[model samples]
Target chain A: MPDPILAARELTKSYGRGPDRFDALKGVSLDIQHGESVAIVGKSGSGKSTLMHLLALLDTPGTGTITVDGTEARSLSGRKLNGLRNEMFGFVFQQFFLNPAASVLENVVLPLKIAGVGARERRRRGMEVLEQLQLADKARNKASNLSGGQKQRVVIARALVNKPQVLFADEPTGNLDTATGRIVEDILFDLNQNHGITLIVVTHDHDLAERFQRRLYIRDGLLITTDEEHAA
Target chain B: MKPLEILKTAIANSFRSKLRTTLTVLAIFVGAFTLTITNGLGTGISNYIDSQLAAVGPGNAFTVTKTDASGGAASGPKKYDPSIKRVAAGGRPGSSQLALAQSDLDKIGAIPGITGVAPVIRISPDYIQWSGHDKYQLSVSALAGAQPQLASGTNLDDSSTQTQLLLPVGYIAPLGFADNNQAIGQDVTIGITDATGSMRTVAARVAGVEQDSLLSSSGIAVNKALSTALSQAQATGAPSTAVSAWTDATASFAPSSSAQVSDMKSKLSAAGYTAQTLDDRIGTVKTVINGIIGVLDAFAVIALLAAGFGIVNTLLMSVQERTREIGLMKAMGMGSGSVFALFSTEAAFIGLLGSVIGSAAAIGLGTAVSGALARGPLSDLAGLHILAFAPGPVSAVVLLVMVIAFIAGTLPAWRAARQNPIDSLRYE
Candidate 1:
């Protein structure tokens, strides 16, 4: 097995200060290796969201350190953090944040454009990703005109266009119906199995968490390894 | 992103918001166009005056006697006070003469670097006649011809020797002359009343028929010949002093250079001589036109200010609407500087369009208005008016407007750039 791609040591996150302080993550530690698909399952307000945010570097930990692919994520700032975030991870949120004014293709190519990729190369790469997601036909349509499944597909295409190492999905199927959720699930598994990408998913669904190779359940800001529970 | 690619993105985005872009562009257009047209008119008017001065000749200067039009003695040691208004009781008020005298001319010629002088003279009861026509009943003028200073023809070699006659232009001889040039060197008889109130016929040969005169053609040519005839006739008998009264003298001169011209003017003015130069006339015209243009530029500035406010509002609203977009961009690895550059570049595109429209509109309006004015009251100043639409100045003004527009867009663009990406992305 390869070394851990992401590691957290006694991670903690708090909102506000003093009497109003709310501890979202309480001294939690975790490890995930390369090519691994890990699902963090928890009820709402159980610190799973805070742990995922820290893992993605979307929010800094209040205590302890996170090293992503060898570099310490906690100490990074400004351009270094931005570069690491852009190059290392592809993020999919429960709510697809697509620019409604842009066409599906434009929305997909946006990250590459911000990364200052050349136009021909960016378009070529963006089209390849869209085609892979079976969204080539809707490329020219405005995002506002796309359906829920198609908009999610375009958002996935956008996230994957830069070919990041890890796909961090926060409730990827939370907003979709059962049938559409199954399709998204199949696509996420296919991306992991075929491309050998590390997948870290944060979801509240009990049945969905059981399918992953590894499951860490967070309750009241404390994480319990499902394998450790089985061993006990 | 490369600036060019970013510019393309900005332009496309701006194009997407058509109404907002159009309104902002319109504001800029109105501002820039107003400035161009008003400035054009001012420039055209001043140009017209300069052209007139040029036609009047740069070297030549004017000198007038200290007298009113009615032959009354003019106020001595008085300058032309622009603040004071002259009012006539009833009839046309006798205006102070702006012309200088022959003595002033001689004095001006005596100044260092002084050249030649031609005295400009206008006679009263201006009329003259030949033998078949009656005397003094017809008011004609005889222009006093100074020696060696022919307006067009051969210069006088000896003003005292030659009784050679010179004809006034368009002088139709009494019915017996065959051809137009027939009276060029032929003898023509003139009738003049003597001091004793008796009419006499005097015969002289028309030496040369002048094609142009400082006075009316009905008057006899007062060449050295005619002057000799009148002087001799006066000695022979009490001939018409009334005919001599019809004559007045004027001198025209050419200075060596422009400095000599200024010196001559100052010297003439200092000596209680009311004189005017071609340059001074042009300066007066420029001053008047500049005032008009200044008012127009002021109005343009007001319009530009209003447009600037419009730009600020639009950009601010854009910032609000694009909060998530800005965040997404920032998270995608665009630097803070890129964010600033993108917004400012978008505003610059709007400004560029506005400048193009303004410049084109200004040229169009200038062409149309100048064409109309040419057929209207400004016809007299048309030559100078046409020269006023100088392309260099207009182009510069258009560029200036574009720059001002970019400056106006700066603040909103800066505000858009400074937005915290985390909060912005969290924005609904």
Candidate 2:
């Protein structure tokens, strides 16, 4: 089989210190292969979001190892790490986090813009992804004016505009209605299966967890189960 | 991010809270307007002084007076000296002034590089009349040696034997001349009291009408022939000492640069003589005026400093309000450096907005005020604009405010840059 694209070992993360300290992630370990659709599910405070933040290189593990494509990313810091995260992964949060003042297209191209992509290429790529997400018509509309589903689509378009290897969606449909949430779920699965990009979703819904090829059930910062066990 | 992209975002972000940003920019406007106006005022007044200085004398020409001669303002009473002859100066202080006689002229003329010398003689005429009008006691001074500014007729020719005079506008009607133009070429007779106390009258053709200046307000400019004729008529009672006739001499040197002028002045000072550059005679008054202008400029700077604090306050609050937005950018792979640049650019944008609007408004209003003053309150003062603007200094004001904004934004931008994405995204 092909090498696992990402591997985490004994990941540990603690919030605060002293008596009031809380360990958000405790000695969790997992391996995800290329083009894998994986679900990390648990109840609130189950450390699923914390584990995803650590694995995505957005937060450092207190004590653990995370390697991406054979390079140890957990120890990396600053520009090199940020560059890796920007070029290798995309994130979608529940809040959407769009700059409401910016046009929808500007919001979508922000990642590529930060990547120093030229204006023409950024426009072509932004338009391409917006078309894929069926958001092409709303390109000129301000982000603030977009509906909840449309705003999430723009966020997804922004994430995919950079064409990273991994898409990390943390409660992507948490704020959407059931119809919009199902649509968003269908989009994430399509991106993983059709585009051959790895999808990592963090959700509390067991139904959504059943759709993933592999599942990691984390509880109180511990990984309780995974479909595969691999040191690599 | 490219600088242009960063700038665009900064600009867009600045107007997110339009009312708050406008209020901050308005604070900077007050500062920039006050600063630009004061700068214009200084420029205008200095330009006027420079034009007026050019009329006083040539670069190489300076008045040579006795060491004891007092001018402008002097402290304490002048001491009595047996050897220093007291000759009355035309517009100088003290009566017991040592006169510059023919011997002193020889001494000055003998100095190496002393190209030319002309004695400025003060002649007080008893009365001046023209075409049988009532004789009026008129003010008179001889300025045939230096460059003469004429309003209507030509300047006096030194070699011409015919006596020619320049009359001030105030004297045109009183001296029986129809107007400034009609007074030209009109002959006027000046009655001078001779050394023997007898009234002697001399006739001179009016060559020009002098433009009234603050220094030459109500005077008649006497030509060389008229000056010589009057001096000799009153020469008998004066002392027969070797250097006791003329009160002052204007010495001309070959080198006209200020550097060489100072060199010649030092040499003359060592010789126990006083030398006053046309600048020196008028420089003290210029300093006092500029000092007043400097005080005005300081107040304007204070206003700008206060505006700087307003910028700091506005930007700090922006950082607080944009906490989540900043975190999102950080999460999108923007380095801390890019984050810092974004906020700094935003502050600079606000500063640019305020200064540009303020400077533009200042130029608009300042020019109008200057024009109104010229035609109204300052009509008597010729060629004086109360305010002036230059492109370099005006642009500098914009650049200065931007720099201040950049400095003020650093603290807030630093806080934004150092923010942890996890914590900031978690911000409510």
Chain A agreement with the truth for model 2, given as TM-score: 0.95
lDDT of 1 by residue, A1-232 (tens): 5558999999988889999999988898889999889999887988887788789877678999998877788667777887877787888878788888888998998878877789899889989999999999988898999878888888788889999889988899898888888898889888988998889999988677777888888877888755343345
Tens-digit lDDT track for model 1 on B1-428? Answer: 67877888888877877898899999889888887777777777665554444433342544333323233356445566653323222245653333333444566567554455544323222234454554333322333433211223443223545445555444544434444566555555555554455656566555655433211234434554555565544334543432222111233455447676667667665755545554554466567667777887898888877887887777778888888888777766677777888888888788788877997888887888778777786654324345256787787777777677678778878987887665677788
Highest TM-score: which candidate? 2
Give lDDT for model 2. Answer: 0.84
TM-score of each: 0.66, 0.82
For B177-291, candidate 2 gives per-residue lDDT tens digits of 7778898888888888866788888898999877666554466767678788877766646555622467788887776677777878888887768888777877887898799
Docking class of 1: acceptable
Candidate 1 lDDT at B24 equals: 91
Provide DockQ values for all models, in the order shown. 0.35, 0.65
Q: Where's the lowest-lDDT run of ten residues in candidate 2 chain B?
A: B141-150
